[model samples]
Target: MAKNSEKAVKKTTNKIVKSADNSGTKCLEDKNYKIENPLDEEYVNEVHVSDFMKALAYDPVKGVDTSNAEHISAWTDALPVRGTTSSTKNQKKPSKRKLREQEAAKPKGISHSLLQYPLIFMIGLIMFIELIAYISLRQIVRIWENVFSWRGKKRTLRNNLRASKTYKEWCESADALDNYMHKDEWKKTIPFAYYDYRLLQKVVKHLKMYRQGDTMEDATKLMDVLYVCLKQNFAGIENAKLYSNTYLGTKALIEEYVEEVTRSIEALASNKYISIEEKRLAFKLYSKNYGRTAFCLSGGAGFGYYHLGVIRALLDRGLLPSIITGTSAGSLMGAIVCSRTDEELDLILNPELSSRIRICQDNWPTKLYRLVTQGSLFDAEQWCREAMWFCKGSLTFKEAYERTGRIFNVSVIPYDPHSPPKLLNYITAPDCVVWSAVLASAAIPGILNPVVLMQKKRNSEHLIPYNYGHKFKDGSLSTDIPTLALNTQFNVNYTIVSQVNPHVHVFFYANQGSPGRPVTHLEGRGWRGGFLASTIEQMLKLDLAKWLKVLRSLKLLPTVNDQDWSSVWLQKFDGNVTILPKSDLSDWLHTIADPDADRLKKLMGSGQIRTWPKISMISNRMRIESCIEKVRRLLRTSPKSNRVGRFNSYSDAEIEKLSQHLEQHDTTNNYANNSDAGSGDELVFLSRRRVSMPDGSFQHLQDKDSIKEQNRRRKFMAQFLDSPKEGNNSTQSSVLFDSHSDDSDSHSPPPSSPEDYTHN
Candidate 1:
């Protein structure tokens, strides 16, 4: 009986284990597991197993999985596991309200379908735009070309001509040019004639170089065609020259054309393709040179008035600079003196004159506010008006030079930082206006605005000016003194440099070899507006100081402690006469637009008094040198006669006699006063002195012994120059043309004066 009972119990345990395994719960998976907890409602006591088995077997509910009910209490308040089959079947159904709450609580993100359509639409739109653009590409390009039609046409024509490597190809360029210029739109512009003139220049260049390496026969063949073109274009050339000075566009075009023509003519002459007479005629008509003395003035704001006194002293001594070059305030002063007589200069220099005209109108406090807001301190119209009035109306560079018989040069820096300073003279920029140039040069970067260069319209009695987009400003930034420009560009024999830049040490002969010391005490004094003025002043001083250091390092300027001071160094070594104020003055007080009349007078007086002795010495030397120069020039030009003995060189006595004649002539009527109007006649009269002989050559020699002594002293100084000291930047080759250097008249005389015309 015991064995049977044990068998039944084992059967019951096996059934329960099978039921738990089918329910698929991990905790009840062990067959030998027994519940030990009496507190857990899901736990069964071992003594109640028989009763529990009876209750499970005889349950009222059919098909109910009792195994799922085993852990009912634990799952009563919790969510059923999702993957279990028994839990899914027996899980309680949640209320509709609870299910809806759970569905609403889920997070909803942006839909991929919602974004897809718009992305596709954007892609399709972009593709459509690309397609339309591709179809209309040529039309769009044509519209753009029309907007810049003239420039495009010019570039095309130039390219067509430049692409031609041979004479045959160039003929086609001529045809192309004719077609291009004949268009009605181009013809009405009137400036198109200038373009045609340029094309003709290209043709001439081509003709000159055509087959030159092999033979001149081919080049000569083109002369008939060339003459025909010249005749056809002669009217155009005349029109171009007449209107060339009218506008900056035409001026720039003509300048380039002239350069091209010059190169072509030079090439033809060098290759013997043209005769000497033809070349001479071409140059006389087109290119001219005036080798004369040049005065180069440095920029100084109010200190520029000091130049007036220097001019007065020079004129008093009968010395006149034939060429004037200046920058900034110097340009203003130079323009004032250009076409005016001594009396006119005196009137302009008078302190009683309106300060607005003499000095620029400067309301610094107001200008500073404008400077920060509008990128400009003040309108330059008043300055322009003053310049125009001083210069006697706006005149072309050529007009100023022709009217005054003095070459006027104004320097200006372009808007481009890399470009070198431009020197606008009669030769370089003949059509540029005098007043405009002065205005452009005087435009200080931070204090005043830059100016757009303008051009005069032809036959416009109203004087309407047109701008060609060229902008310029203060020249002092690049070339402060402009002395080197005088030497290189105009080939002036003598240069007088008047410097007023306060930062640069002048080392006057009166300084007695004392070391230069900075005036640090004047640091913040005399600031005109505020921090702006002081800052700009300090910056200018610092920049100038740095430049001085550079010059010293390069040995261009000597050290203060050097045994042999560079007093008159430029004059001795570089053939430049440098003048400076002996006493350094306050910068802002002098540089400002409206300075104290007393200070201005004092400055002018100082200039006149201190430079008098130097001017007296220089004038004497110049008179002698001028006599020699005129004699040499006359000898080369005057007809050789048996009656006239050829002089290889003049003796001291002959030079003395010539100098005495000049001095006497100067005394009879101040040459400075009369030379401006009739310079040609005066030169001719001076040249005639070659035939006249002094009554007492011996007496003249005795009188000129002092001059001979001066020459000896110059030679002694020249000896020192030959042996450059250590740390000196000078080299023998670097030395410029000296006073004693031989000068030949290679250039033809001016054509303006009939008296100057001579047969070569």
Candidate 2:
């Protein structure tokens, strides 16, 4: 058994030796010998056991069989054993030292491994760089698409804005953008920022379409968005001007949007909280567009004609100042004539004919002019009437005439150096005095009737009348006049009226000293006869009240009081009171009364009873009668020595001397009593001395203490009067005592009265 065991051990040893050699050869090939195979369990176990024994024995041994133990163990355990083949003679076994030397001879740096795969590393790096570039480009494209896509969806966006939810969302989104993004960023990110601004505008517009109640809040928010966007994106006027042209179409759209916005602003402007800046902005926009919009709808000619009527009414009511800067009366007349029809045009166009008749008869001159000139027609006549009504005929006929004359003079007639004298005269002749009287009469109805009645009944007529009989005779005086005729007529009339007539002649009767035959003596047959009659009648009927009201409303009336005409006289006549008589107090009274009978009556009845009448007529007969009564009263009051005897025949010099004395005395007294005198302290002092007041006492009492005491007493009296009385008994007692005291005072004059003194 021992011998058999020995053989087995020998065989196992040989196998183990062979396996070890094989393992060593594999290790030499791979270089990582520490990586063991799991399948070699017996070789691993044998190597481990050998390592353990060596460790236990503390042997510092080399070449221990730590490897191939699992293989060795497996071979020992296996039952079958194959017969070994004989080794080839040429295969020499390498010694362990030789193996170590061979392994050390192999190249061993990381560079060698890297060098093996150069192409793979390069390819991977290139791919990474390409990925980063593609990502950046993709993001840029996405942002671009988002910005430009807004334009295509603008319509859809607008339609969707009708929905309350969509509107709110839009506003919120816009607000968010405004808050988060810088203005520069918005300008860059939003393609055509102004175009995007239109979106908010659209939202506001649709919201506005809904009635006041439903969409007001939404509309307000949308408007705020628009304003903020505009303020942020386009702040300066230069930017606005540049953008206005660059994006003209967009600007036009904005203009339309502004029109709608203006209405909304106007509606809300009355709210106390709305800022004045907003209101001013709205008004600026409105004014900028108003003329253009009005022109577009009404036409330039129509606007001119409308303005003409306005001018005419303004002149009639005396609402306009004497000197108008921007607009001319000729422009106004041209505007009106331009609106006339061919037939109406022909009447004014006839060189031989007069314009007065045409003006009086033509109801649609202003309207026709507007139609002809502007190629547009509105209710121009109605507008004129309304404007006139508002102006209250503050425009006088004389003013209208002057304005009309100015229009003709400046605009109508061409200047000619070599023109015939007759032609010049014809062109220059403005029956202005005649036309003014006629126009004034026509413009104001209150002043028209009395003049007409006087012309028919009275012998004297002061104004020139138009031949209405001849004017309406042809029955061709309709509105179908040619535009050229009207234009030419306007030019010719203006030229003629503006010229200075060199051949003006004044004829005097042989009996120059005699009073001219009461104006009634010359009423026979020519142009003067009819003109005077119609003119006087027209003058009488001018109701200035309506015109005055209009002037008042327009704030054009002069600040002069009718009762205190002294200031006017003082300024105009250089302090001479003689001009007061020539001032035509009757005409002034007529002017005040014709338009305002009620006002005149109230003023006349206000204070003293005797001097002025509540209502007065402008008839020559009424004036003469009033003057006669005044003269009779003066005669009755005068001393017998100063009276003129009916039988006394006096020379011209004596009569003139008497008249001069009376005139001087009357003038001096009037000047002294003049209420319009300056109220300066110097004047007041002079006036007090003239009135014979005690100068020393008055001056002594004029101290601050006295003035203060006087004021306090006045205030106390006012308070006492204002306070309610206790009852009827207390009121009766107060009244009875006051009456009794007044009667007693009247019965006995004060001893120191100035009136009771006799001159020594």
Candidate 3:
């Protein structure tokens, strides 16, 4: 009876039942893995809900941890009988075509070593050798060709020299430089270096050979140095000359020079981060870190020397800034980083890629020219246009900001040159964008010239109205610009709340200039629409010059090229001409070129005794170097204050409260976070931690450090700030490298970050 009952129970358990596969799982039939229908017509509509139904028994709202639950209760407890489990799962024979494919797919019964492809490898080696031999033969032929083409090489070199824009002899403009430097009586007030005639002579020689003649001579020099002019008639000339091309063939030559210079600059093409292979960036933001406090970077002018080091440190440690304020040179670094793909960024940030970034200030000759022609300089807007023309295969400025909101650039503008200067937030600048704005900001007094924005006049293809007062400069000149504008526009103070960082607010200026400095006006703007604009308009009143487009619409003042009036004004005028009518344009330019006319300076009634500032290449370079040295000194040296790290005693709440209570501290960024500025020691400590230095002081070794430098800076800073009262000298050397050392990492590390920057 017991055996019969067990048999009945087994039979009931194996009874056929149909069920819906809610989980999409297929039921296993038997161990042999034969496919068979589990349902029969008698139980076709049956459905199982046990697995899902059991889920309701667990508590999900209270944060239950049942992830490890494993029970057989969810599975159907039925097993097939031995006599009916597909009867040994008999194999089904495949069709003839399938059998043939299977046979063909089988490997040959041979030794594994025979499949080594040694014969193919040998053939490839022979081919490579043959290629090498062929290359050698080609090189031998080239050598012979070179020997025979000696004359051709000379001719090519001569042609290249003549084609260069810097190829100049000497000009009337050079005389001013000579007098300013060589004049002894007036030299006492000016520095000795400005009187260095050799530099003046050398620059003029290169200036005269452009074959463009003296008409565009001033323009060429200005472009070479990236100069700008804020005020017109700075020399107080009641009568000013406009577009000095009064010669017959001179107009044509000037046009040729323009085209030549444009073509030449544009021809300096380079790899825009080769797109031959697609690549991924090394640093990718984690999903969890989204919306976290971002870093802020503000750019200063020509500060790339320092910004370069800071960027590398940030990348090494995976810290991305939430926002950025990129000014002059700061803008350049920002654009470079933002525009590059992560993969391209890795290669671009390297010191080796220095050749690719062209900063006009990098050269000595140009740097000198910039200082000499500070306010008298004119901009070469053509340079910006050409730069973009060559950026063929790289991510453009606009594209970099298409997603991720990594940067929020500030553009200083009046929106029209006729208007007053105003700071703009959210980078959709009226006329200029990223790179263009960068050049504008670096349009420092002695550096690059300001870019002119032209608004097409109504129904006049021949005329364009220029409100040049609408200009932009480096963003760092006013790192607080965006914040100020942001506050006013949104009607909320950033000190209490931030649009970016919620936990902490940080605003950093990567370049020079102070946040407290007010926005300055360009003197030329008022003059543009005043008597000068009227006079130029009267000159362009004639239709002939407009029809011929005579040398940058000479007929029209303030056209794109004529934004800054007054051609390279020479402090040292070539006063060699004894008697030519100022009205006679052709005779005057030619008369001064004669060697005998040089004596006219003596013949003239008397040499003016005007005092000129001593400015020269060496002095200008020294000025720049001194500024860099000062920055390094400040960063490398320990805090000068009697209270080194007073904030160590404050709690996070105390710090936050102190940061919030003070009207000086912005919720996110506080550029003037000095402890002395306010009673808050928290901001002072924060500011100290962010001081900019050189690469060597980074505390964390990026590469090749046998002794680990990681956390050394932080620890050192903590010790300095919170340690028992001690002089900075004792521990300064331990935390920083020698600033004057000749090594690559001789200086200390700059402020850390890979943050977002807004540029103006």
Among the numbered candidates, top TM-score falls to: 1
Q: Give per-model TM-scores.
A: 0.40, 0.16, 0.25
Give me the candidate number with maximum lDDT: 1
Judged by lDDT against the true structure, how good is candidate 1?
0.43
Any runs in candidate 3 off by more than 4 Å, and if so which?
1-294, 361-398, 403-405, 413-432, 453-469, 478-481, 486-760
Clashing pairs in 1: 302-591
Higher-TM-score candidate among 1 and 2?
A: 1
Question: lDDT, candidate 1, residue 618?
Answer: 48
lDDT agreement with native, every candidate: 0.43, 0.23, 0.26
Please estimate how well model 2 matches the true structure, expressed as its whole-model Cα lDDT. Answer: 0.23
Candidate 1 lDDT tens digits, 1-760: 2232334333432332232211111111233433332111122122222222222222121223333322111111133221111211232444586567554643344663355456545544654554354335424433543454326665577466545432223334533543454321222232342234334444544544552443444433332222222221121332322221211012223233333333333243333443333222322222122234677777777777777667655654457666788878788778877856555554445333334344445667877876776456765554555566656666777677666556788888765444566788776676666777887888776656666444444664222121223457777765665555654555444466676655332312111111111111122122222334334433433343333333323334222211112211222222235567654546455466655545555555555544433442244235433433433332333233312232334453464444543433332232223223333433222222121135412111233554464344334323212112221121111111121222211222232222233321
